[model samples]
Target: MTGLLRAEWTKFRTVRGWVLGMVLAALIIVLLGVFTAANNYSSCEGPDGDDCPAVPLGPDGSAVNDRFSFAHQVLDGDGEVTVRVASLTGTITYPPPDHDKIVPGVVPWAKAGIMIKESVRQGSAYAAMMVTGGHGTRLQHNFDGDAAGSPGASWLRLTRAGDTITGAESADGVRWTTVGTVRLAGLPPIVRVGLFAASPCDLTVTQGDLGGTIGKCRLARAVAAFDHVSLAGNPWTHDDVGAMRGAPALSQGAFRESGDTFTVSGSGDIGPYGLEGGQPVERTLSGAYTGLIVVIVVAVMFITAEYRRGMIRTTLLASPRRGRVLVAKALVLGAVTFVTALIAALVAVPLCRRILRGNGNYLLPVSTATELRVVLGTAALLAVAAVLALAVGALFRRSAAAVITAITVIVLPHVLATASVLPVELSQWLLRLTPAAGFAIQQSVPEYPQVTGHYVPQMGYYPLPPWGGFGVLCGYAALALGLAVVQLRRRDA
Candidate 1:
């Protein structure tokens, strides 16, 4: 078995064309990655013209939107704030009929309720019991946490006991139902308890004439009127967390108090930042598609060349065992492809990231573990794709037909799903059923059910989780190899 593996490796390296093909594959990946990053430049005209404000990072180190209106006062220790939400409404800028007129409406995720926070800082830890525009009532905490509460409730309350915060909702402000409880580690003795309101931009997606998706985000704001506010604290101080200075007057956040009634209005969101206004690290690997083509052509020719030259009979006569010979060839090819791809990915990711930063583009932060998975997964993807191509070549014994079949199954599905105008559901189905499911390994951002955004292939969201989709591709490779083994045993070498 070891001798067979060594012989196969010798054959691969002894061929100058094959060795140069692998080198060209790696070079394509690196060059295209750098080119993609160099072309991505972003600029925002702020006080320091062409200077963009830094995005806020949440506790988990991911970029987040933390702009909202708050009417808060200091709380000494364990305390509670209760407020009755009289109404929740908002205006959407430039909806359908007249592209220039602002219409009155609230997006589904617009929220207004009572909140308890460690500080007035944008990414500070906090818990809230809120009423959403369409999702009824919810208990949300620490940015990413959410629990659904009684729907259609107008009353909200938040109580703090030590570091534990409990949220409850009521219909009549009398009988309260505890919605959820969460603990904020390292909560200071003094904190901010307040009433708040926030709304995200209204996103509208339409199909383009050319079979692509067109998404437009319009400005939206939510206003909430809070009456019968019950809390013991000093005078209320207004704050707009993460607000940009010198913004439009209408877009600015504000609050008003008339006796016991407080009305707060604000724009922006308090959740995970989507793909807008930023780039994901995987965006730099856009060249993987082209590089895979080079790999496929080389892998197909690797096996077919032996058959075309009538050398398979001599090689098999030495090995005698056909199955072991095929296995040895697969192992040699898979290992070579994996090492080549790993080196390319290791060079492309960081080099492209620096280019992206230099061009004033904000990168959505990812954890170290997730970043490692993306890099390793990319190498594994190319390696397994090579194995699949080799198996297909063994089955067909023709270079052109085998290469075209492998790419049609693997790469074409991805392009159609992501770049074409197919319906989102149909595109998702293609990813699930085809070998292109392996591309899910490159997705860095996850879909948050709590946040409303376009979760489509074009937005880098996949139907399956990372490893699960990779497993689907592996299954195809294994099945193809099995068929090739059976064919090799029955056919004349």
Candidate 2:
């Protein structure tokens, strides 16, 4: 280890090209991270509030006791009672018994997930997913593969693994894979599970507008002796882990539904589109974080190019220990990228928090945990990328061609999908196979409607969960590293 460390250190120090690449990687990462984070939070993030004009008053000047229909309910004749969003405003004739104390309304605590079963024997909406809007209502995405207003087809489906529940899907089902493990949540838990989805599409969306209400979304059949259910994972967290902190609160806050004619105070939370002054729908910023990945590939090319120049051989000759040389390079790359990514995260997170503070209801209350997640996660991601680059570079001595090939393979197909050249059927399959699919981690959103054999298929927020996305990326990194090691052992310098 010591010899390897020395060799790596010497090799890295002597190579001005490597140093330049490191610096470049850091600069690009910082700029992109800060720019993207600030923009999203400033415009759309918010907390649910307790202001209602929808509740109707009674004939004797009393508040009506309406049964809770959706997620959030406004206080009427007083005591804590649930009501639909559309009913928030009206005449408060018969005020509730505890009306004074009910200053405003907020949603109660709840979580949503996808449940997989051996079979949807009853055919009761084969897969049921729970979704929450900006207003904090519980809704379900059942049997609808494509969400309303979405561009794609019925991109959702279920698959089975013998008697076990395995959610699966395909851009085209010919090549399907397991999304995640699913089952019930607690002791004597129900056989089926909850599904969740979110729509950033509504026009009236606001910080307070990005919630939903789920009246009663569930699965029909019992999941008997299931496996891999809880492990399905959340995908959106891959590219933007920080988004989780600003996610719509399931427990508190008033989620509003926005509109062109001001906002419908009584209506449920507006979707992401309804949020006031949010990123334009067309400019959703889908590619920013992915750019960082490209930069990593570029750096790898710079290093790998050295091998083609026979520079690596010279490097090894100078150092005398092949392993030491590799270790040194890895350390330098990891250290530099970690610091760079960390600084970017620190600057970007607070800037976003500050910008989002403009919204009165949705304050950016970041905790220590959120901060750690941002910094640590960024470093880890970059480190993995760097290691992969090292492996790739070492395996093929030519830098330019390898870099180009890597980038083309990793990023090109996703680009084609965007252009509509690739069908949804093919695209869904590609989503799992590509490195870009790993970006699902950055999502603050959770996917819903757990099904068998889908990519974290439980809901829209998934299709790929955070940790799972990371694991996928890690797997690629390990594979690339393993291949490089094999070549190193077999070939003569």
Candidate 3:
């Protein structure tokens, strides 16, 4: 083990470029931290009538109705922007007494989108859904960014099949991901959705000119394109309620009512929903996961680069033992990932907490376990990548091709699993087993009902549970190491 470590150390130290690579990675991580801090601090709002517009976001900016309360304002073209919603103090009544009998109640939904065309100018928009008195719930979809084709490309969809409400997203007008789901309260008597928008600040403008700026944004002009806008599920009416009332008990279970509570129940429960009810910072933490992903990629490339140079043979010849070499490579790779992940989380956590604090109810200080999982799990992910790359590099002894193939095999499975929307049984199996699917741990929310996707032995079917998924990744590493060992013993240096 000592010889193996020393040899691995010698190989890493002998390469000036590799030493510099670690430094460069650290520098990039520090730059990101600086950027996060600068962005958050400059966008801070004051106690009274701050420059930042405060409004709750919906799918798009929709007008509020009797059952819901909403307000919105556009900031400058670009800056830190946020919107929020709070249940207002009134209850609206619907005419249909048995609206519960129809599809139960109205499913209120909302959308928010912003437009950033030119460098200096930008605008924010929102939309909401409100139903006359009937038992229904809100299916709020957040489309806050200015990306996508906008008007059409960036919108939310809420559809109901039987008693289930499915929320989906569309990049173009075609494909979609079932982003989320919710069950409405028992035959809701009424439902309402809210809309909001916070435009970005004009970074080019002087501070003195900021207070005088106000823009006339028309909803009608922006809303005209919504002709294609439609709602699925049961759009119950007053007449249909009589037939639905006192109907046979719901096949799933009874809906419990409370004062605007968010709970998961029924057979269709998809584990837990990640509520965006916190301050701006928490949302930022959730979104910046892409950064961690980038670091993982870099780590993989670092180890694989050696194989391209045919330096790995020298590495193996010095160490002789494959397992120890793999372990040392993993330790270095994990160190790189762990440091990057910690820095990202540390900077993101505080900034996110500050933005989300007080204004919109957000989970602040972040959970210790969650933070540990993010940073340590990220290290583990990179470690696995390093193992796979080392194994591949050892076997192929060619860096570039091995790295490319490793990425294709490891990352492609997740994309395919996500895109496959049919063969419910097959999809379930793929979701748990796919390499990318394992990364879904970052989501912290299960995609479907726990029971719906569970493994079935009789039908010759199996799916990885969360921990089991980790095992699969380990198994891959083990198999690669095993093969590398065989190759090491068989091949001549």
Give TM-scores for every candidate, taking all chains together and pairing residue i with residue i. Answer: 0.95, 0.48, 0.44
**Per-residue alpha-carbon lDDT of model 2 for 1-493, expressed as tens digits?**
6666665556565677666656565555545544554455423323344322222222222222111112111111112111111222211111235323322221211212232321222212222222222222222222222222111112233332322233433333245433433332221212233222112211121111222211221111110111122223222111110122333222112222223111111212111111111222112223335545655665575467566677767866767656556656666666666676666555555554444443322331223554465356656766666676667777776666567656665556446434444444555555567664554444442333322112221112224566676677678877887777667656887
Candidate no. 1 TM-score? 0.95
lDDT of 3 by residue, 1-493 (tens): 7666665566666767655655554455445544544454334444354543333322232211111112222222212211111221111122235324322221111222211111110111121221111112222322221122222234445444333345444545467545455443231222222122211111121212322122221110001112122212222111110112232232111222233321111111111112322232224444333343444445555556666666667777767765667667766655555565556556655654555453343342234565566445544654565566557666776556666666665665544443433344555555565554444334332232211122221111225544466667767767876887776677764
Residues 254-280, model 1: lDDT tens digits: 899888899999987788777764899
lDDT of 2 at 195: 23
What stretches of model 3 exceed 4 Å from their correct place? Answer: 23-327, 351-366, 415-430, 445-466
- lDDT over C-alpha atoms for residue 193 of model 1: 88
Give candidate 2's TM-score. 0.48
- Candidate maximizing TM-score: 1
Off by over 4 Å in 1: 47-50, 95-100
Winner on lDDT (1 vs 2): 1
Q: What are the Cα lDDT values of the candidates?
A: 0.88, 0.39, 0.38
Q: Assess the local accuracy of residue 467 in candidate 2 as a C-alpha lDDT between 0 and 100.
A: 67
Q: Look at candidate 3 and tell me the lDDT of residue 390.
A: 59
Task: State the local distance difference test value for candidate 3.
Answer: 0.38
